[model samples]
Target: MRHTDDKELIRLLRLSDYAAFEELHHRYWLKLHKLAYRKIGDRQDTYDLVQELFIEIWEKRGTLNFGEELPGWLQKRLWFKLSGFFRKRGFNGKHQENFRQYLENQGFDKCFDPAELREVNACYEDLLAAINKTIEEMPNRMREVFILHRRQQHTVDEISDKLNLSPKTVRNQLDRAIARLRRSTEAYDATALEILFIVWLIF
Candidate 1:
């Protein structure tokens, strides 16, 4: 069986040809959705974005110029859609511009460095284990309160309400837990892994 040319498939799609559109979808759906998913992160939002983009293609097929460059056209549309999503979430201008630059210059499909990522992951795990050991040595209520409030993203007020402690107690536990984490993590250099761990603790 002969594979269809992507440009030809797009041309047919613009001519209201559903068969060619289906072939195009089969050829590019996974790649496009993977790109979108990495940017969007949420599973449901990824699905919705991909579905919406294709629905838009069909809905606007009549106005599309068949000779258009498929990759550029598709990516431009996707980026605009993604930007609108980001804007809705309150991304500042600089953040949006940087994201656009990254996608355009660095190439979205090739963002991750496998070996470096592995080292970062290993360092992160080590930091976690050290922090866990420190926390485990803490007295009972302190450890529980620290983990529940700090590590689990609960607000001090919520932690206090849930544990029947004062908000001041919750904050104190968090400060102590973070100080302990800082001591355990300080042995590492300021690698991305260490930086991430420090930021996590401080935040």
Candidate 2:
């Protein structure tokens, strides 16, 4: 598809046209997957993230700001998604005063600089690796419950039915999974919190 076709496709997308969604997905899937891969370094995660990104864009098309370049706009949204992933993973704050002071020292224009971007990516990669490692080491039952609830997007009720466990048991398993993750990454909490703060500053 030509660059000009993006606008027409987006227009159609706003009207919930299936063809438009399919064409846009065809046009950008590879690039979006590559973008997600560069940050995540996991093939499955990259594919899932990209798919989620497109689903979100398609769902919100009526209110989307396509801007001049669709890819540019998409990248910004992907960054936000990545940031949210970290935030949800329990990056504990390092004293409110320290966080505020750190934010005060940073400026907006540098968010896009090569060095700053590298630092941001490094922080993100580190946190992601740590989280994945922790999850990998989870107890079998907890891991299964965590994966079903978080990665597979299954509801607790659904997981309980699938696993033949009580709903409270499923919820308890998920809570334990999160607690274990937080404990596993406590050493990096300060750095991850600072990194997440920078992300909030940027977008």
Q: List per-prediction Cα lDDT, in the order shown.
A: 0.60, 0.64
- List, residue by residue over 34-113, the lDDT tens digit for candidate 2: 65554455687668878888888878888988888887677666766766654453332322333344344433233332
Query: Please, what is the TM-score per model?
Result: 0.43, 0.45
Off by more than 4 A, model 2: 1-4, 90-203
Report how far off residue 44 is in candidate 1 (Å): 1.1
Residue 165, model 1, lDDT = 95
Instruction: Residues 1-203, candidate 1: write the lDDT tens digits.
Output: 02778777877787789998777667667777877765555678778887888888888888865445776557556655554454354333443443344333323325432223222333444454565567768778888887675446576788888999999988888778667767777885434334333233222
Give the count of colliding residue pairs in each prediction.
0, 0
Q: Give the C-alpha miss distance for residue 5 in model 1, angstroms.
A: 0.9
Clashing pairs in 1: none
| Residue 27, model 1: Cα distance from true site in angstroms | 1.3
Model 1 weakest lDDT span, ten residues long:
112-121
